[model samples]
Target: MAAEQTSSVVLVAVDDTVLAQLVQAATTDALADEVTPPLTAGRAWTADRVAWLREFHRVRRAGLAGPTGEATWAVVVDELIVGSVRLKHTDEHGVLDMGIWLTRGARGRGVGRTATAAALRQAASLGASGVRADTTVTNTGAMAVLRRLGFHLTLSDDGQDVRALLLLDPEGTAACEVTSEPS
Candidate 1:
């Protein structure tokens, strides 16, 4: 259960300093535990952390990418950023990939869902026909949110890992001519 805190939230872009700080803080915390061993998969947190910081800068610099293009937004609650979402169109593939993150204190409190929904709406507004996202099978929390967002599961393997895809296009034209479910 999440903390019983009441907050009126707003969605803003990544250019805002406060939102950037919040994203960095949340991302650092998320990498803290998974920074080490078995989950590391022979990787280094120092490097990954640096990469994340760079990404933070880029996301911040993205500012307003307009309605039909990639955009980053932060979920602000009570004037504080608790989460963020990134939605962009992969022109090569003609599909939009949506990404989201929520602070530790904000998790399990519906922040992710709210932010993701906002991102979805933005994607639709961007002239995108559909939106899609993926997460490791172990990410049950994210999976739950994605499922509720009407994502269709296309594939899964026995490694307790899975990949999920969603379609946000009502007319099914923005993504592709495939008006059916993903394989």
Candidate 2:
């Protein structure tokens, strides 16, 4: 599938300085409620700039290594940082794990959908046959988006978290429409 584009959203290479700021913004009380539980470690790092910078370098180093590493991008809208998406190859061949999060202001818009679709397309380019994602059961917004993106529930052990998977077509299409606005 070709890259998807939105008038308001774009996926750009993650900038350590900007990412650090975005992470700090996410920890604010106003935005804290919008952050997913799985991202708690990231929020915590905001309190320690040194640690966050170190992690940033580590992530960058890993990305430079190979497919076994991760590919992360910043979700930008109107030239402002709004969120992030990451795709990491798993132990299983032709399969990757995806993670995404948007700021409070960006939620309920089409930013997440567009950014996620772009990440999935990137995964396909990397030879991934499928992508998996995990989200807390209570994050109904994310779950709904995953469903809309053709991801089917694969596991929901304990009811606290759920895992979903989307299998790419042989032709590499994700088989989902990239609408301009969120449903």
Candidate 3:
């Protein structure tokens, strides 16, 4: 028996609409520790639905926005937001960071690959200099997906966590395309 999957997964721009909430809800609900930020440990926080809602549109509408780019949407089967991904801009040199999550029931259905490809497409279209991602070493699923997307492991502190890096270049021979073509 296979797991039930979301009917569809489409990446759209995040807007001040119901669609934004749908994305946020799915991401939050999928979190193993709503109180702990995925990137870091021991950080106390709560899922601020309203805050995320406001910021999602405010930043998404920026003039620099791109299709499937920063501050966007990934619709999975109508309104059932099976997966969500984002690229947060920061002041640090390599500030473009990505976070993604898929509904528990939506796993093993390619939602992760779909959402990641959408984000990469957006990044490539936006002329991004580079893109970076970090995942726990134990997160084999994430590592596998990243590898499929051409993300190479850049740093690995012992065996606990690994930092994978992917360049979003529009010219280079890097294959940004993600499909289930048997490898």
Candidate 4:
């Protein structure tokens, strides 16, 4: 499935064809600092790190039905892979965890907001009552995007992390219509 928030930004499900592009995009535009755990939070992208990145997506490709209960998508712009977005089923019933990251060039634009909006709609479609996202206090960009997307933000007591939550409508209505693209 593909969710387009604008003509410039699209979220395509992670498949073998898209997976390679996703890794390439990461190596070229993203820092290890911005990705999730298991990746060293530093500037360098070593061969081992790249290999791990490739395997990470491969293992989770099953998406909602996968053992990890997570669905990831490659964020494409003007037909080029630029970033990624994901939604994961959480232990809390009817809630999903959301994540997103963009290439350095894509940051500061509305791309993150658009991709996140699409992810929220996907969560709602999957019967989620809310979506949660967590980021570091230093990640002002992510904090701003989550807030603009209508998520309630709470700072960690240690002032190191920020948690954001957006409750969907009770009926699970999509925030906007995402045009479907054929697989």
Top model number, TM-score: 4
Q: Give Cα distance to truth, residue 172, candidate 4, Å.
A: 2.6
Candidate 1 local Cα displacement, residue 119, angstroms: 0.6
In terms of TM-score, which candidate is stronger, 2 or 3? 2
The full ranking of all candidates by TM-score, starting with the best, is 4, 2, 3, 1
- Runs of candidate 4 exceeding 4 Å displacement: 1-7, 36-42, 174-183
**Best of the two (1, 4) by lDDT:** 4
Best of the candidates, lDDT: 4
Cα lDDT listed for each candidate:
0.61, 0.71, 0.61, 0.80
lDDT of each residue in 88-129, candidate 1, tens digit only: 667535467877767677777666666666666666666666
Which 10 residues in a row give candidate 1 its minimum summed lDDT?
A: 174-183
Residue 34, model 3: lDDT of 31
lDDT of 4 by residue, 1-183 (tens): 886554467789788889888888888888865654556646688777888777777877888878989888888877988888889988988889998888998877677777888888778878899999999988888887777667899999998999898888877654434333221
**Residue lDDT tens for model 3, 1-183:** 997543445676555564566545654555534312343343323355435545554666553444433564554645565655677554444336677766677667666776777777666665665667888877788888888888888556577888877776655335566643322
> What does candidate 1 score on TM?
0.67
- Candidate 1 root-mean-square deviation in Å: 7.4
Residue 162's lDDT in candidate 3: 80
Of the two candidates 1 and 3, the one with more favorable TM-score, higher being better, is 3
Q: 1 or 4: which has the higher TM-score?
A: 4
